[model samples]
Target: MLPFGRVAIIGLGLIGSSVARAVRATMPTVRLTGHDADPAVRDTALRIDLVDDVAETPGAAVIDADLVILCVPVRAIAAVGTEIAPDLPAEAVISDVGSCKAEVARSLAAALPDHAIVPAHPVAGTERSGPEAGFATLFRHRWCILTPVDGTAEPAVERVAEFWRRLGATVERMTPDHHDRVLAITSHLPHLIAYTIVGTASDLEQVTESEVIKYSAGGFRDFTRIAASDPTMWRDVFLTNREAVLEMLGRFSEDLATLQRAIRWGKGDELFDLFTRTRAVRRSIVEQGQDDAAADFGRTHD
Candidate 1:
């Protein structure tokens, strides 16, 4: 069990609700509370017994709580942090599950006091949004990155890691800048590309649009599934992580042009070599257990 006396989760969205449910499954004795800006969500959470108690706002949720998790959108991190900053318990540890870490850390630092405020990004989620979409096994066997700011207490960081570990996540430490840049390429860029291609396909003429949807097999269908992810959440991610994503996109465009040229010129050797090299990378990832063909379908469940 975590050393935390109380765990308060703000914003009962998909990620928040998933964590809340997972905590209950993992630690039944821990005192848990829920808060959300929307009253309907709070009421639903209460009806479903997703939390022991429900609060109306961020301050009410964190009062007397040892661990407070901000599980709202990335854009609202600062505002939520500011609202609960003054009322935060003196020894409490504040953390977040926002996708973008650097922006969240900068905002929370200005709002909270000299307490431990660890910015975390649990690399697990689903295309679904809202409270009903959450599940108890969302974080199981997934990676959770903690990016502790300078001056954050070591004990507080360890306690936070313990909490995540109890819920079956592999905890890893990273600098906020590094986390943001890496995710920009891996997560953010992929989502952006998915949304863009899906949008393009939708904008095709009526006949072509129907054909595209009808013929969508593994690749295009996979993009569609990713593109179906929460729009507001993704909009906030792109807006906040603009610089890193833009830089990555530029490089991606250059490589895409090369691949396009190769395909147009029937350069079979270049295509074969590129595919072989990329296949090796996939093999290395599989050997390290980062991915498995058997589990590819399982990722969609989260």
Candidate 2:
């Protein structure tokens, strides 16, 4: 059964496009309406048939939608919410794909006031962007966390959870603040470190751009891939999730300093113990099906 009769998507970037494709693949009968702020993206979405209809504006897209998913950046959610509020159906559920949940939940509630708001974060993506980068299988076996605020309708939350499951995602519910703090360490901090490391490598006097690219090891290369993610989206994530990100970042810096002192003092035992423990963490992730045990993270075609 289709959880939503008519679905509206605001934003036509990778995640938005993926949602469209995934929905079309899994629920061929559901009517889809999509609107992107960029004309070029709207055209691309139409060219590729990403949605059933390309709306001229946010308000137009959600005119009669039963479920509206905002795939815009975290900072823009409030503005988008306000934009669509007038045309939004009274009983329509408003949700989002923003990584930062706490602020977004607050923003949507403030902007819409009377709508059933349930914010979600699909903990899935590639180091890619644009409408064409989407795939129907992007959310397969991945986690989609719903951070529905207090007083949200129970059935609305359940419908949204079921919708994500239909799109191939495993669903979990968490408080918005807890979601933000957890993601700060799992996602936001890693992206920040990647961006910094990749930037530092580019500015190194001894290493030319060509040399850096040519000698990029798997570790550095992976960091570069993550660093290459959409800057605008990540910028909003950091700005909105600043408190949690900074807290996690401070802990990370302290740990780094400890490692630095250990290396300088020839504390091989300390290094070995940390590496061993970290290796076990990786093993646990693989065993839990969070990642593949295959070499190169199963990128190889073997």
Candidate 3:
């Protein structure tokens, strides 16, 4: 049986449009309805025929949906939940694609007290945005974490899991708090570091901007790619998951200080050991199929 016959996606950004495309590719008979706050985005979605229907309002999008996935910023979840609450079907399962889960759970619960809220975070995306930037295979081989609060019906949670599985994602469940902490270290902190590094490079007075661009190495180029992610989305992610992010940041700062001291004191053995361990981590990620081991991260050069 199909997990959901009718689906509504609120927000037509990269994730939202990708979901629409994935659904169409994997489950052609299932109906898809989508809405975005920006009229230009809505027009683009319509032009691309991204969904079966492009709704003008959040409520309208979910009026007949069996599943409504909010793809908006974490800070906007509560408002969007409230907007769609009135028209949401009684048995519809509400999920989201936001990275932060604890706050999303609280926001959805407050906005729609009677609904089944299963917050999800798809651990996949490129440094791209907008309806036109999506692809049907974005979720293939990715992990989608579902954080369903206590008392959420088992069937509803399973349905959400099955939905993701059909889209070629491996689904796993975690507590909202645990999900926040794990993602804080694995995803959020990395983005934060990337943004900081890229920003610092740009603000250096010793190097001209054009010179920095001209001499950019592989590491800095990768950081710049991450820093190019949507500012609004990253801003909300940092704010919504501040506690965990801050905790992780503190730990990172201490580790960085240790590395700094090692470099200053000529502790070659200490630095070598740390680098060896970190290199193993990269190898492990590749072994687990989470990343490519191809030369230069699978990039092609002419």
Could you say which candidate leads in TM-score? 3
- Flag regions of model 3 displaced more than 4 Å: none
What TM-score does structure 1 among the candidates reach? Answer: 0.94
Give lDDT tens digits, candidate 3, residues 147-239: 997889999999999999999999999999999999999999999999998888889999887887877764688888889999999999999
Off by over 4 Å in 1: 295-302
Residue 205 error, candidate 2, Å: 0.9
Q: What is the TM-score of each candidate against the true structure?
A: 0.94, 0.98, 0.99
Measured on C-alpha atoms, candidate 1 has an lDDT of 0.90
Q: List the residue pairs that clash in candidate 1.
A: none
lDDT of 1 by residue, 280-300 (tens): 997887787666656554556
lDDT of 3 at 34: 96
**Order of quality (TM-score):** 3, 2, 1
